[model samples]
Target chain A: MKPWWIVVRKEVLESLRDRRTLLSALVMAPLFGPLMFSFSMQTMLKRGLDEQDKPLQVAVMGKEHAPNLVHWLESQGLEDVPAPKDVASIPAAVRDAKPRLVLVIGPDYGKRFRAAKAAGVKVYVDSSDQDSQRDFRRLDQLLQNYSSQTSALRLAARGVDPGIAQPVMLDEIDVSTPASRAQSLLAILSYFLLFSTLIGGMYVAIDATAGERERGSLEPLVSLPVSREALVAGKFVATMAFSGVSLVLTLASFAISLRFVPLESIGMSANLGPKVLTGVFLSLLPFVPLAAALLTLVASFARSFREAQSWMTGALLVPTLPIMVAAMTGMKPTALLMAVPSLSQHFLIARLLRDEAVPLTDGLLSAGGSLLLTGVLLVFVVRLWRREKLLG
Target chain B: MIHVTGLAKRFGTVEAVRDVSFTAPDGRITGLLGPNGAGKSTTLRLLYGALTPDRGEARVDGLLAGPEHTEARRQLGVLPHGAGLYPHLTARENIRYFGELHGMSGATLEKRIDELVAMLELGEAANRKTQGFSQGQKVKVGIARALVHSPRNLILDEPTNGLDVMAIRSLREVLRGLRAAGHCILFSSHVMQEVAALCDDVVIIAGGRVIASGTPEQLREQAGTTTLEDAFVKLLGSETAEVQS
Candidate 1:
């Protein structure tokens, strides 16, 4: 076998025995993203389904004054509970309420209704509370519906057309497909995937360069007849192997975990079945080499294992920056955007999740761009390895 | 044979190895004896091509030795000062790694490893992880790794730095066996007793320069001293005096 292959084999064998390497590459890094994703998705889905299915409950004061309004609210899925005795404490009562909401009817409400005059009511709620806002909005809609009904009846009684109240209806039409709508949530999946890819090879990259030097084995290894290029190439390939395995495992975990999340209830389905998983893995495959090369290059400059580890933490953020930017700006992918490595992969992943056809040129550009950078980084790493100061 | 001529290397302004030259012939043991910070390790590094010389050349078996000369390196086995083994790897695996890197594999490599284990008396340690190995055991594994390819020449920089008396004795025996096998052996040390006990030729260096070179008996005779230690001190003292003057 060639010298580079030997180095690769040795590195792989050594790293496999190391518990830290195996934990990060196989267990921790790959599982972290998928598990967190599934848990959060389940929580959001549960919250959404609960909001729609459960009836809104409100503490209503002066129930007798607006009995008709109370009946209408009950018909509109608002349950009335007994209100506080003192009207002065309504704010504190709302704050103490389960859903933190209270409805109060004025003493003149019935008189005003009988006289066909404007009536008054109050809804006390804490806008600062996030969980109560949904209920508040539902209660507000019910009151608006009751007011419109009363107005329409008055108009009909006067022989005026009630349809004049709504001259122009604003019917909202959401054109986003279910898959495309899911893209917003699934954008995070790309970030996790890219993050796992870098983390997978992190220990091995550090171990191969800084760790070896610290262990004092580097001097003997470099003193051998083997070329520095072969050694570096071997280490790089080993790091890529770990990163690739991590990517595949992360994809598989996401595919499996996403099944338990009720995305359908939220009108957002994750396209992470076997086929999409395979496609995503392929789209991300090109990034493994780049991740490995980038990590190894950064680690090569580090003087010790601890220093390498600290630098690598910063390096892990390099590929994620483009993804974060793309997600924030909701950047649309153009042909030219494919030339940016991590951002291009993000676009491809987004397209795949949306079930949109990925252009062959975009795929080529993304893979080409990543591999080109890998090549450049590998050259720089090899040159760094050849320097005499590298022994330090 | 290993030959070094006018080797000079400096780290910024400090000349770590200044005008130094010596030769280690085949079938003989040559010790580069020096005091602490006396350019011993730097000289060995230059010889092994880990560092290039600023003003000279190192030749291993008639081939110029530098990072570019793989052929010359192929002829040498080096055990750098304080060299370490992969703690996660067993002693045998560590030796096999170097053997394979030297392009040796299959039965030939395994058999050589077996011989080394027996020769070094590594015993069960050969198959055990080196993480908790004693200092002596680590040194043994390091030497075995260097000797895995069985190169014609060997260079060890302070191989006995942290070894116990027994470990040092065994290490000396290993070097003597290599010399008997017609291998050119060159090692550096700050200990005069070690060189006097093992070396056939001594190259004494002080402050990055070779102050004297001869057989232990000849060095003592030249310095008019009864013991090799006194000769070393006398020569080093004279060199220091001359520098001060």
Candidate 2:
């Protein structure tokens, strides 16, 4: 066997024996991402389902002025309640989580309806509240229906055709598939997947580099006949191997856990078939080497394992940038984006999940870019090792 | 043989080693005797290719020793200061790791490990992990790892700094046996009795410079003292006196 492979085997074997490294890097890191995703999805879905089953309560201030509207709301599964004494009290009630929807009907509502004029109905809701926001939309749709029905009755009383009031009939056709809509709502999926690939090898990389230096064995090992380049290559390969296993475990965990999420109830479909899983795995594979090399290079500068861990934690923010920016800007994946590293992999995973046909050229471009970066990073680490202060 | 000629190294503005030169010939044990901060560690580091010299060279068997000189490094085994064994690995595994790096593997590496384990009297500790090992046990493991590849030359920095008296006596015996086997061994120490007892030739260094080099008896005669320790003190005292003059 080559000297480098020997070094790699020793490092991997040593890390595997360390219970701390194995627990965090292999078992916990992979499981955390998928578990976090499923937990969050399940919570949000549960909230939405609960909101659907619960009755909506509308607080009306001038209930006497709009008996018909109140009656109409009651027929649509909305309960009527007397509003608080003052409009300002409505915000306090909402803050206390008392009522999510409130309706304010002025005394002039009766006069306006008798005179056939537009009457103002003020709806007070905490738009910041997610549940209140859903209920408010439902209440708004009900009021619109009541207005049209009342207008038609007035027209009938005047012996005029009710169709004269409606000049145009409009309908909306949504062409988006459940998977495509799910892609945006579940943007977190790609983030967690990429994060898993980046973090899975972190403990191994630090253990091989900074941990070796701390143990005082690095100088003896370096004094051997093997070249520094081979030493670095061996360590890098080990880290990448650990990361690949972590990625596989993470994807598998997500695949199994996602089945129980009830995504169809929310108009989102995520199919973790063998094909999609394979595609996501392949798309993330090219970046594993780059992540390992970059992490190892940065960690090599640290004087101790704890110091290296802190720097690695700070470095993790870099990978999260692409996803954060994409979310903030609602970035559409362009051809140029397909050539970027983390963004490209994220884009590919999303596309595969959405059932979009990702071209072979896109995959090749991303892979080539990642490999090129890995080569550069590996050379940089080798050079850093050659420096005298690295022993310190 | 190991030759370090006109070797000089500087750390920032401080001259850590200046004009250090010595030779440890085959079939002999050479001692580098000096007090703390006397550049003994720096000189050994240069000899083992752990540091580059700012001036001159270190030659192992006529080949220049430096980072890129793998051939010379293959001919040398180094146990640097405070060298540590992997606590998680057995003593045998630690020795085999270095052997593999030197391209010795399979049955040959195993045989070498067994021989070194017996020579160091580490039979009981050979199969166990090195964690929580005593100072003597740790040194035994380090020595085994250094000699795993059977290099022509060996450089050890303070091999007996923290060892017990019994451990030191056993280690001295091992060095004597290696000398009889025609291995060139160079080690650094400040203990007068240890140097007087084991070294065939001694190089005394102070302030990063080699002030004197000779057999222990010769050094005693040069200082007109019967004891090697007094002789070494007198030699250092004269050097300072001459610098003042």
Candidate 3:
């Protein structure tokens, strides 16, 4: 047997017996991503649906000044309540009612209406509050209707045509496909994928390097007749095995669970058929070897398993950061983005999920760039293993 | 034969081994005797290519030893200081892992493993994992791994330090057997009696330099003392010898 194969065999044999590593690679990592996706999407959709179904409750102050407008609002399903005596307490009253909005009318409301001027009215609700958003939009539309109707009546009284007052009308057109629209809801898939690829091989990588040192066996192991390259190569191969298995398993679980979600209701389809799964899995392959090599390098420099774990925990953010940044900014996927590691995988998976055929160059750039970086990291780790201080 | 010529090593500002030279000829048991922190482990490490000497070279079987000395290292079996057996692997697996690293595999490896296991008498624990091993059992496991490859030379550091009397006696017998088999064996120790009983020639090291080297009786005659312990103290000219049991 090749020297490195011996090392890999031993590592795999031991890691298979380790319950913690198995739990993370086979069970926890695969299960968590899909379950989290289903629960969060279900909750968000339920909240939006419930918000639209609820009655819009509004508190009207100085009702006599705007009785006609209030009657119009009531006819449109606005359940109005008498405003509290102290107008200053309107914001607090809105908070107490929870999701109910407050509408305040000033004393000059009657005068402003008679003079054919803008009415002094204030709407009290937290704009940042998610549940109050639908009620806020309803109130704004109601006031706008009242203003447009009054303007038309006044224009007719002056013997001028209301149509003459109108200019070019603006039309809104959305060109988003159902799959593209679902991208926002399914953005989290890339994060979990990146996480699995980065963290899947971490346990064995640390155990084979830092864990060996802590156990005091590294001295004898390094002193063996085998070249340092073969030893490191063996370890890298073993780590990649675990990492590959974990990445595939997690993605499979995520793809399977996505099918059960009621994505169609939200104008989205998560049909992770075999074709898309195969594409996603292939695009993500480059990251597994890269993650394995990078993790081994970091763990090799550490003196103990505990120390390696600390460094690994911090290092995990490197792969996760790009996806997070792209998600937060809602950045559109560009051809250039396919040249980066984690970011490129995110874009490729996004395109595949959207049922778009990815260009061959994009796939090559993503895989090639990641492999080049991994080569650099592998050389660094091999050099570290060759050092005498590696026994620490 | 293992020949270390003018070997010197330093870590930062502190010199571990300075101008140290020695030779353990074929079929002889040579002892490297030193006080605590006297560079014995560093010298052994340099001989086996675990460390690079800042000056000079350690040649194992005529080839200079260092990280690039794979040919020379293949002929050497080393029991490094504080090398622990893998707790998750059985005694046999631990031995086989190192044997495989040295290019021993299949029937050859299995045959060698059997011989070492029987020679060390590691019967029941041979199949059991090393987690529950006693101190003596652990040392025997280390010895078994070191010998599994059947190297031409053997280097062990403080092999009997933590063993009980019975274990030490058995270890001494094992070393004697290896020496009789024509393997060049060099081991380091702080205990005078252990060296006096096991070594054919004793090399006394103090402050990272060789202060004396000769047969046990010759060393005693040169120091003008009857006991090897008193002779070691006299040769070093220090009251801090503090010979271990």
Candidate 4:
């Protein structure tokens, strides 16, 4: 037992001493979520709010016909960026972000409006840019509104029933919690966090132990006066340390991002404060040890680092089963569902982001069960220490 | 210090180490000589409690080779094949880290580290990360790590696996000095000259069985040959001897 403690202490020291693993565990992954999430979420939210119903910038090209059409769009709030008359200039202007909408008025455009005809105007648009699309759609709606408003006025001028010009109007309302709104986008991010904790740490864990054996270092380790049980614990803790750090970082990232993402822009009022973020971090805690244990089992039998990496990767990918299922059909955060490995973290995190209190039972059950599984793994690893092939 | 009786290990259908037996006296250098797959490494693993035999028993200071076995291992030190140093750690850090694993603390661990560094002539490289060191330097660091905890028994597996002549000579000198100080030393090797020069007793194994084990002179006498190499060939069979299977 004493000697095994030495092995465990050594595992930690070596891990800390290794610049690559240290950087990945303590610095890289932890900051990854905060950095990427905050940047993306803030940008998206700002764009969604600031750019809503924005005016389209149209470039005029070829044949000045309907001065009324140009006057109609200016009234709709479009400020045009002057464009060259060449047809090729349409693509070039859109590419340079000079104009989002390029309208080529034909020589017969005045004849078309006077005839009250559905004569077409060639309009080229940049379809790929979401902002450009929003502006384009608004411009389309404004044009249609202008034509309708003119028709109604014309009918009124004829002394028809003004009341009969329009009988109906349409408005829309969205009723969803701030958490649910955030969950809509963050569910994808959650899947990635789950993978890093489970799959990424699985690689680190298996490689630490099984890699040593395949390299034939296990014999020296065994030949020392280290207890088998302590050796298992040492390896287990080292792996879980890597996982725990990642879990904390991933949750902290979401928590910080949500709190600071300015959800009011999207009409969401949810706040990811100390309590909520803490709950989220707590929710992910159980998965850390469970993931480590599963990977440890796979690594113990692996013949080399590559073999362990592949096998543990396959094993860690087991989380994706629940991820795929959750993605296919949303899961309700039930006590039973939340207690199951892989799925539970994602399911509960989705709820947590929606500002739903993670049920105490779910957190306890998941943490308790994972810790129990860790015990089972520790037992197995200890037994593995006595195996000749693995030890030597 | 270590006893083996009819030990055997089977991996599914293939038996890696078969029924074999030997005794290692305390305060003596015991050489385990065999071909690459002849189970010499396996035998060493049994003594370290790394492997559990499917049959018979291997005991170190009366401790059976089993899962969780550690009582006898406390007085044991090991320098595995290739040194097994984590490449990222400095030499001083590596020694302190393993020493801590053996429960050496604060002042004691520091003192031990200093002594090992000084003894191994590694003052200059002690602070350098192992990644940049030459093979001989790494091997010396490995020896320092094994001796850090001051175990009564030391096991070196292919201690000279890849070394220049100077490094090998240095290693031989270290082993000889440790032997002189009454430390139980066990090493596995395929080199005849190394074992003949450093070992006080030799155990020659072939086909997973111990064919001859005695003092070098005794083994030579048993084979009616003057040289240890000649005696090994006679006992383990001719170098040109062919196996049908």
Which structure among the candidates has the greatest DockQ?
Answer: 1
TM-score: model 1 vs. ground truth: 0.90
What tens digits encode model 1's per-residue C-alpha lDDT throughout A1-392? Answer: 99989889989999999999999999997788899988997898788888787888898888889998998899888877777778787788677655378888888999999899989898889887876787899998888888998999999999999999879878999998878998888887888999999999999999999999988888998789988999999999999999999998998888888888888876777877777777788899999999999999998999899999999989988988887787689777887779789999998898899999988889999999999999999999999998999998
List, residue by residue over A49-121, the lDDT tens digit for candidate 3. 7766666788887788788888888887888766766766767767766426778777789888888887878
Instruction: Write the residue-wise lDDT of candidate 4 on A121-158 in tens digits.
Output: 77777788876777778878877887787777777878
List the candidates ranked by DockQ, beginning with the highest.
1, 2, 3, 4
TM-score of each prediction: 0.90, 0.94, 0.93, 0.77
Cα error, candidate 2, residue A175 (Å) = 1.4
**Residue B92 alpha-carbon offset, candidate 1, angstroms:** 1.7
How much is A124 displaced in model 4, in angstroms?
A: 9.6
True contacts kept of each: 0.85, 0.79, 0.77, 0.65
A1-392: candidate 2 lDDT, tens digit per residue: 99889988998888888888787668886788788788888898888789777778877788889898788788888987666778878888975557777798899999998899999999888888877888899999889998998899999999998889999877899988989988876667877876777687888889888888998888888788888889898989898888888888988999998998889988889877899999999999998888888888988889899999999888777777887888789988777777778888888988898899999999998898889888988889999899888888
Which residue pairs in candidate 2 collide? none
**Under the 3 Å rule for N, CA and C atoms, how many clashes does model 1 have?**
0
lDDT of 3: 0.86
What's the distance in Å from true for residue B130, model 3?
Answer: 1.8
Considering the true interface contacts (CA pairs under 8 Å between chains A and B), give the fraction that model 3 also has. Answer: 0.77
lDDT of 1: 0.90
- Could you arrange the candidates by lDDT from highest to lowest? 1, 2, 3, 4
Q: After superposition, how far is residue A259 of candidate 1 from its true place, in Å?
A: 2.2
Q: Give the range of the ten consecutive residues with the poorest summed lDDT in model 2 chain A.
A: A93-102
Proportion of native contacts in model 4? 0.65
lDDT of 3 at B87: 85
**Candidate 2 runs further than 4 Å off:** A81-88, A144-170, B237-245
- The pairs that clash in candidate 3 are none
